[model samples]
Target chain A: MAKKLALIASKGTLDWAYPPFILASTAAALDYEVCIFFTFYGLTLLKKDISDLKVSPLGNPAMPMPVPMPNFVQMLPGMESMATMMMKQQIADKGVASIEDLRRACLESGVKLIACQMTVDLFDFKRSDFIEGIEIGGAATFFEFAGNSDVSLFI
Target chain B: MDFDKEVDAKNLNCPLPILRCKKGLNDLQANQVLKIMATDPGSVKDFEAFCKQTGHTLLQLDQTDKVFTFYIKKRNDAL
Candidate 1:
């Protein structure tokens, strides 16, 4: 039997969203049965329209700035958008696949996606608001999958 | 090294090369070799780990300048 991989995506920032999707897709490519549990802010990525995903630069010290800026300076009104643009530009310049492309790849490669039912209710999100192929489940379901996985990650 | 199929993953970075190689390998019969050429600096370690995890055989790995070439034979029992 193929080894299993379980990933927990708990953040929604543009930068925070990449790791789980990237790793899950790569693990699936390696023939592992992969599953990703999206919870809290991470549920935003599974929304039908992800264009609203933003980067919170105000408190994110790790947000890469083209020009070094202090945390206080990064808190300026327009800094979040500016930082988001810079990050997107850098990702494109590096030829890395876009989030949309990665999502598609993950789906095509058979990486299972699960959205937290508790979060969906907390956020008042309708089932139709999520992209296709998502399973709605809570902690028990995630624990069941994680317990059976050979690799488990929280990203 | 000889291979049944060739995949050009040059100029692609990180997971793209591995993703492309995986897609290419899917079409190959068991024990058939798939060759991948990539320019990503990370591909050497990536392919090694990929083979180890997927149960494929890494037949050859050669590098020239910025290009990295890998030959992988599909595992007969791997899904």
Candidate 2:
């Protein structure tokens, strides 16, 4: 039997979004069966329209800037979008795959995409609002899968 | 210096190089060697972990400047 990996994606920021997707795709390539459970803000990534996925620079000490900016400046209106744009540009410049590309790669590699049913209900998301091939489930379902996984991570 | 196949993963970062190497190795016969050239600095550890996890043979690893070259042999039991 193939090795199993279970991952939880709980954050929606661009930087936060990459770990589960990257790990899942890589684990699939390594012949491990990977399942990613998207909950809370992470459900936004599965939405058909991902334009709202912004990087929160405010209070995010890890957010790298071309020029150092104070926390107060990051709290200014529009700063989050500016930081998001900068991050996107940096990712593009580095030839890294975009979230869309990574998502497609994960699917191609047979990684299972699961969305939190509770979050979907809480956020008023319709099944049709997300990309195809997503399985909707609650924590119980996630625990069942994770129980058999060789590796489980909460990212 | 002999390899049955070569995968150029230059400029690809993180898991991309390892993913490409995994896919490339799938095409080779048992014991056939594959050479992967990558520019990502993290690929050294990534490939090591990949080989360890997948049960492939890491024949040799060499680095010249920024490029990392890994020679791997496919294991027959790898499916």
Candidate 3:
């Protein structure tokens, strides 16, 4: 039997969005049956249009900056947007696939995408807000799949 | 080395190359080999791990002028 991978995605920063999609696609390529449970802020990643995703430098001192930046500088208005654009440029230059591409790959490779039902309601998201082919479920649904997974991760 | 098919994953990073390699392998019959070319710096280890997990064989990995070339033989049992 193929191995199974269960991932819980709880964060939704532009930087944080890559992991669940990347791991799920690669695991699918490796013939593993994979599923991702997106909750809280992570549900934002499944939105039909994700152009607004932004990476913030605030409180994330480890984020690379072209020039040394103080915490106050990072907190300035528009800094988060600037940082996000710059990081997107860097990712493009590095030939990294965009989050949309990776997510598409995950779906094409048969990785199951599940959105937390409570989170959807909490965030006031309609089912139509998400892209096609996703199921909505709660924690128990996550455990049902995770219980049989060979690898389970919370990202 | 000889191969039945070739996939160009050039200028793509990390999992793109790996995913392309998987797709290439999927199209071939058992024992057929797929050749992949990638420009990702991490392709060497990435392909190795991919082959390891998927039961494919990495026949050769070569690098010349930053272009990485790998030859992978599909697993005997692969569909």
TM-score of chain A, model number 2: 0.94
lDDT of 1 at B28: 95
State model 1's lDDT: 0.89
Per-residue alpha-carbon lDDT of candidate 1 for residues B3-58, written as tens digits (9 for 90 to 100):
99999998888799999999999999999999999999988999999888788999
Question: i-RMS, every candidate?
Answer: 0.8, 1.1, 0.8
Q: Residues B1-79, candidate 3, lDDT per residue (tens digit)?
A: 9999999999998889998998888899999999999998888999999888888999998899999999999999886
Question: Which pairs of residues collide in model 3?
Answer: none
Ranking by lDDT: 3, 2, 1
Model 3 Cα lDDT, one tens digit per residue, A6-43: 99999999999998999999999999999999999999
The TM-scores of all predictions, comma-separated, are 0.93, 0.91, 0.96
Give Cα distance to truth, residue A109, candidate 1, Å.
Answer: 1.8
Clashing pairs in 1: none
TM-score of 3: 0.96
Q: Report residue A108 deviation for candidate 1 (angstroms).
A: 1.2
Q: At residue A28, what lDDT does model 1 achieve?
A: 86
lDDT of 1 at B26: 92
RMSD (Cα, Å) for all candidates, in order, is 1.6, 1.9, 1.1
Candidate maximizing DockQ: 3
DockQ ranking of the models: 3, 1, 2
Highest lDDT among the candidates is held by which one? 3
Worst 10 residues of 3 chain A by lDDT: A57-66
* Per-residue alpha-carbon lDDT of candidate 2 for residues A6-43, written as tens digits (9 for 90 to 100): 99999988888899989899989889999999999999
